[model samples]
Target: MKLLLTSAGVKNASIRTTLVDLLGKRIEECTALCVPTAAYAMSGGPGAAWRQISGRASTPMSDLGWKSLGVLELTALPSLDADLWVPLVQETDALLVGGGDALYLAHWMRESGLADLFPSLRDTVYLGVSGGSMAMAPQVGEEFVGWKPPAGGDAGLGVVDFAMFPHLDHPDLPENSMADAEQWAAALSVPGYALDDQTALTVVDGAVDVISEGNWRLFTP
Candidate 1:
């Protein structure tokens, strides 16, 4: 699978160039699907979070030159079923997944059967922001310093081998600090990546590359 996972969407020239290169075309020529399901999971039935995610995600894309952008409300999709989304997803050159509550996003991914479809969509460039990145991993734990959601079962989709903790040291986000990331990593059984706002991890054909304009670190179990 080709994945560009970021704390914040495409923050630097290096990352933007990488994306354009991966698309095999200029940003303007590519078609994309913006999924704000994660934001919905945290917004609690249509509010500020929901309103902000799409624009926040798309504004950057527009600035970068992507002309064709489609917003997808997974909950409103014919069904959460992959069969329903596969054709539409296949038509897009890439996917832009917004972030909010990781577990909430994971739950929908599973319920909609999207988690099971990821491997098949390996050819599609998947760009995940914040919670979107974390939810794709094998396991995602307390992303915030003191915020823990109810526990019952698996916490993530397990699409990727490692866990991701985003927004490390971001000024506006309280849960986002390198120290908190380390603490969260220590509690995890698997390896993890801690990324600041300007950093991202790009995975292509099993290879991982760190793309950063800010700072990031990795933790091993």
Candidate 2:
């Protein structure tokens, strides 16, 4: 599986280039599945989900011209049989995951059986923005915990061994400052990263690389 984890969705030219590189084809030639599951746990969730699905959000995701686009509502997957969605997921070119509550997304991914499919989706790209990106990390600090999961963890899935602090220094999120990120990383048991809106981390076949046009930092435990 390929991971392009971003603080914001393809927010700059560098990130866009990286995403295309991961796809190994033009965006218009690829099929994508948008995951709006995370948005529902946040404030103005329905509206947020609409914005993401309609490509009305500032992020450059759903609007990107794809050969086809479909919604993969993780919350509803469990109710349906795996035969209904599993085949579709394994065949998709990419997954565009929206941002909101990391733990919430992690919960559904596990409950919906999506997590189990990761090992099988070796050729697919997992494009994650904001909380969607954080959901891939081993943990998220207390500062980023909003919608708590049933298991009651202040974190996310163990998709990656490290943690991440996103939206660093964003004007709208004062709490996501570098200082806050430093403290958050200090408390974590694993290494972590503080990513600005322009930064991203790419992981393929266990090899990790950071690509950024703005700034980011990796802190060790």
Candidate 3:
């Protein structure tokens, strides 16, 4: 599978170019399914959440040059079943996962059976933004998001080998600083990457590449 795990979602030219290349066509010709379920999971509601998340996703999604299929409530996918939603995913060129509650998103992706289908979609690009990126890892540090995991380690989708700590040194989210990232990395059992808004981690097949316009660091034991 082709993956573009970004901190802020196509914030730099290199990342955008990479995504367009992954599509293997002009941006205007492709269509994407924007999964805003993570954002909805953060809202802690089943009803009013959609309205809130859709509003938040508009601007960042516009930067992704394709006709969006609006929002797919991945949290609700389990009950809906693949017979209903699988076609939508199969038809779309990519999955643009918006950022929010990483753990919550990870839960639904597994439960909804989307995780099972992802690996099969080798030709489809999977673009994850912030929390979306974190959800794709085996496990991630929740300190940056001010959330506590269970007493034991919390597992993510396990789609990728490394854990990600995004928004490093972001002035607005001071908790997501380089110092905080270092602290988070120290506790990680697996390899970790600390990425700022201008950076992204791209995985095509088994190879990994870092695309950056600002700052990024890798910590490995």
Candidate 4:
């Protein structure tokens, strides 16, 4: 599957170009599934996360747009039963996983039996934002460093071998966050991509490429 791993959303012009470039003419053709991490729905109801993408409540798939589907309002583990989540993945042409807590999303994907559904998602393009990008990596480092531990290891979906360090230079981050990312990347002995806000890492057929207005540093083991 094709992956559009952005540092953040498609806000900046350069990031938009990156998305459009990777998406090609299929931009509108593909269905975008916006999978919100647990943090996205911490306070609001299930429909709240859905509104972040489509600007409307999470109703039938047809009501959203473009013959596609998006999965929002994913808070608790039990909420992702086959009745609710499976149909969306089965019907969609592609999926866009938004940013939040990467570990939480990974755990939910497994507990809800969603990880087992990957093979069936052959036709789906897997697009991911910050936290989503981290989920595609082999490991995200200290899973419980910032939040409480979920059920599993920091192990990601393993869609890609490289580990991604998102929001490298985010304005809201502490001064040492970037340094911490760099150190983590070095210790892991894996290829690392440092994505500043508005940047992206686009992977297709195992090849990795960088896309952004800002700079992205790559670390090789």
TM-scores of the models, in the given order?
A: 0.87, 0.98, 0.89, 0.76
How many clashes does each candidate structure show, in the order listed? 1, 0, 0, 0
Instruction: Give lDDT tens digits, candidate 1, residues 127-181.
Output: 8888778888877875432223356544687777888888788777776677888
Q: State residue 178's C-alpha deviation in candidate 4, in Å.
A: 4.1
Off by over 4 Å in 1: 43-54, 57-63, 78-84, 143-151
Sequence-dependent TM-score of model 4: 0.76
Candidate 3 RMSD to the real structure: 2.8
What are the lDDT scores of the predictions, listed in order? 0.74, 0.91, 0.78, 0.64
The runs of at least 3 residues in candidate 2 whose Cα sits more than 4 Å from the true structure, single-residue gaps closed, are none
lDDT of 2 by residue, 1-221 (tens): 89999988988989889989999999999999999899999999999998998999877788889899999999899899889999999999999999988999999999999999999898899999998999998888888889887778776788898888888999998888899999999999999999999999999988889999998999999
What ranges in model 4 sit over 4 Å off? 17-26, 40-51, 54-69, 72-85, 148-153, 176-178
Worst 10 residues of 3 by lDDT: 50-59
| lDDT per residue (tens digit) for residues 1-221 in model 3 | 79989998887778888888888987788888777777665555444235334544422543455765556777678778578889888778878887777887887787788888887897998888888899988887656343434544567878899999988898788888888888888988889999998999989987899999999999985
What is the model-wide C-alpha lDDT for candidate 4? 0.64
Identify the runs in model 3 with alpha carbons over 4 angstroms from their true place: 43-59, 142-152
Please give the ranking of all candidate structures by TM-score, highest first, separated by commas.
Answer: 2, 3, 1, 4
Best-to-worst lDDT order:
2, 3, 1, 4
The stretch of ten residues in a row with the least summed lDDT in candidate 2 is 148-157
